[model samples]
Target: MTTPTRPPKTRRRPEWLVPAGLIALSLVPIVAGSARLTQLTTGAAVTAENARFFDSPVPVVTHIVGSSVFLVLGALQFAPSLRRRRWHRIAGRIVAPAGLLSALPALWMTVFYDIPTAVSGPGLAAVRLVLGTTMAAAILVAFIAIRRGDVRTHSAWMTRAYAIGLAAGTQVFVFLPYTLLAGTPSPVVYTLLMTAGWAVNLVIAEVAIRRRARGPRRRTGTTVTAAGARLS
Candidate 1:
């Protein structure tokens, strides 16, 4: 008898890619935030860039810490293997509260902080307000959805919330080319770049959400066809 040959096993996509990319994207902002936190805690030299943070430290500190937790811990939630285990729920609990802490303090600072007009003009302030509110609201909606056993809606809203929270990291990359070519952007240009960063993140989040929504249906269809073939 001829030896039977077994088909080669298909390689599964690495579950780490999504989370690793996200954490890498978050690194720049996290490092910057850490420096700021160290400055605040250790009473380091305060320059014009950091003076505002010193003036009202609470909101900025809360924002930095909360956002760091949200971004780093939240990234892990994207891993398929992690999501399949109990880690997802545990991370979600921490991530939701961290997101709220980040967004709410960000809104507070945006409204009340004595930010210079050059750094954050009225247009940028408005954008910050809207996105901050949206992030907070999205977290709340996701929490409610999960509580009601609506997993799909919960996942979609959490993805949106995470995108907004991660916008700062994206902003660094978005501004790099402009900063390099033009040598430090004007305030208007800065605002535009920031908006572009947030827009890019939100668009990507929507695409991912749609793809995830379609995934189950595709699997179900494949299984049904296979079953029919077997029966026939």
Candidate 2:
């Protein structure tokens, strides 16, 4: 009698893991944005940290609400099961516009908000302008790519845009150590931290895109090898 055959080892598919992690990372900024929105709507105590928001409520509100929608719903787009369904297309329509609304107003705030130099120096403002422009441009390119039926390009661009938009979430982690070790950061230090967050996200996005691009080739190679083995 032969020994019992071993059960086939199946690899776990982390379909939900990326989306869940993204949503979790986004919670800090989402909660903070909600609090700011409440303060704006409810006539709460206006402190120096938020007086600018009160003075220029429209852009801030648009940015907060739009970003919340973009990040939360957009994160769901990463779910492979959802992408296989029609929900992905429907959500894409909403996510693209939401991304634009989130990004454009950020540029507006960066240019016209009149934030004090002590709070956000020229360096930080410049970086914000660059990142906002990049995010908006990436979304636009992604939309155009999908329209042209270039799905690979569309996905790559969308990933870049999402990564840039998610920088706010990552900024919380980036600033925590600095805040704890140094008590408070100077405007220069703040700018550096912000840059680091954006840089980290963009780098990660690039790596992911590259790896995804290779996946199909790898599968094709494996398929060909299996076929050749059968033939031999």
Candidate 3:
């Protein structure tokens, strides 16, 4: 008698893993921002860095609120289960506008405000301007793509926008430890850290998008193969 056939091994799809990771990775900025807001409201002893935010609070505050909402809500979109339900669409509505608001105010501040030399140099300023503009454009294009019923394009563009929006979160992880250990870094170091954050997020987003695109093609190939086997 032959031995019993083994059951087929299936790959487990951890769809929620990315979203969970995004939330966890973002906690640093979330906590820091909350503390700053509390301090600002309570008139606590503020440093020069904090005073800059108070000087031109509108754009800074707007960027903080909008980016926070976009990053937090956008993270939910990665959950496949939520995408099937009403959560995705509802979150999309908030995310799109919030992303635009976030990027626009940032661009405005970069263009018009006198950026503190201690915070950023010419290199970092230019990078932020370009990234801020691109993020805004990505959000707008994603909105148009969805309106035109191009779900794939919409998803790709939104992924890009979300990646840019999360750059701040990534930067926190990159520079916060160093800053704590050695105090504020030089402008060159700051620029490098900022660039690293953007690069890392964009690379990850591209990989995720490519993997998502391949999934449908893989399934179609499997279906066609099964049909051919049946005919044989």
Candidate 4:
């Protein structure tokens, strides 16, 4: 009897694509923050109008460092290679706490930090406060979910937290065009743009989660069809 011919191996989609895109999207704010940090370290002249920011800088530093660690390392969690290699869990040990610190500092800044009245709006502050608080809660709940052996719930909650945390990255896209056109948006306009950023990112996150939820069913269907063919 002739040996059975095996089917050609199907090419697996690159699981790194999504995480790579996410990392690229998040780099805008990270690079900009790094540039500013460099300037500060090099003894750049401080403007009188914004002396407070430079003077009491711990919150900004905390926010930047925490955000960098969380977003960059967190994005890697989505890579299949990292997951298979078990590095995702290793990274999560750092990412989870970093996410909490990233969001809580933002909430703290929203509450205690003063913004220039001309550009500051209550609506934006409220948006920041709510998103930041929820992000922190998501991280906490995810941690608890994983400990309880509910991996699905943990994944969902962590995704939500990460979606919220990407607000800064999304904001770059929103503000750049507005700034180019308007030269400087009013407080109301600024609030709307920032809100749009968070809204868009969350929407994308939800869509991605839905698609992921459907993937297993699709694979199962394929497996069943192949088995039936073999029996026939």
Q: Which stretches of candidate 3 lie over 4 Å from their true place?
A: 1-7, 176-184, 216-232
Q: Number of clashing pairs, model 3?
A: 0
C-alpha TM-scores of all predictions: 0.88, 0.89, 0.84, 0.85
Residue-level lDDT tens digits of model 1 in 1-232: 9764543444667889989999999898799899888899899997877788999999998998899999999999999878889989998889999999999999999888888766764499999999999999999999999999999999999999999999988998898888888887788887899999999999999999998876632232133231223111
Worst 10 residues of 4 by lDDT: 223-232
Query: In candidate 1, how many Å is residue 229 off?
Result: 15
TM-score of candidate 2 relative to the true fold: 0.89
lDDT of 3 by residue, 121-202 (tens): 6488889989999999998999999999998999999999999988878988878788899888888988998899899999
What is residue 56's positional error in candidate 4, in angstroms?
A: 1.6
- Candidate 2 per-residue lDDT, tens place, 1-232, comes to 9665443444766889999999999897799999999898899997777788999899999999899999999899999889879999999999999999999999999888878666674488889898899999999999999999998899999999999999999988999999999977887788898899999999999999998776533232133231223111
Q: After aligning candidate 4 to the native by TM-score, how far in Å is the CA of 14 from where it should be?
A: 1.9
**Per TM-score, what order, best first?**
2, 1, 4, 3
Of candidates 3 and 1, the better by lDDT = 1
TM match of model 3 to true structure: 0.84
